[model samples]
Target: MAPGQKLYPRATVRKVVKAHSGCNVSKNVDVMIFLDYMLFMQDLMKEATIEAKQGGERGVTARSINKVTKKTLSKFKG
Candidate 1:
């Protein structure tokens, strides 16, 4: 947890991992890795959204990434 960062409840974290893993409960290491990846992706999405709103060419890249992320997240859906 970082300064100014929101702390998610342990149950919420476990639920997210289970949903992504398609299992009752994911391994601790796997959960940590997934959470890290999700954080990176969220940051990317935020940056892209901002750029797109500003009419930047990078908006195209953002859209592409969003599509890919959506597909990947679908596979992990609980």
Candidate 2:
């Protein structure tokens, strides 16, 4: 993402979920899902960034993301 672009917050995601599902989630569930999602993305990005650097990319470009996505997902899989 570009500079200053914000990730979706937990409240925003909860609102979206409620809009789609027509039900409210408990606060604890929402927070747990939000934090897990954030942490997963953060870890995935870190792996992609390292791959990008190894590939001589100036930044984490789409190529780097695509290259690392499958491996990252497998690593993060439960």
- State every prediction's TM-score relative to the real structure: 0.38, 0.61
Candidate 2, superposed: residue stretches over 4 Å from native? 1-27
lDDT per residue for candidate 2 within 1-78, as digits (tens), equals 999998767677788778887977775667777687888899889988999999998999999999888987887676
lDDT of 2: 0.83
**Candidate 1 — which residues are off by over 4 angstroms?**
1-27, 56-78
lDDT of each: 0.64, 0.83
Among residues 3 or more apart in sequence or in different chains, the pairs in candidate 1 whose N, CA or C atoms overlap within 3 Å are none
For every model shown, the clashing-pair count is: 0, 0
- Top candidate on TM-score is 2
Task: Tell me the tens digit of each residue's lDDT in model 1 across 3-76.
Answer: 89976567776777677768786447556666867876776576556656666554547465564566556544
Give the CA lDDT, 0 to 100, for residue 38 in model 1: 88
lDDT value, residue 2 of candidate 2: 96
| TM-score of candidate 1 to 2 decimals | 0.38
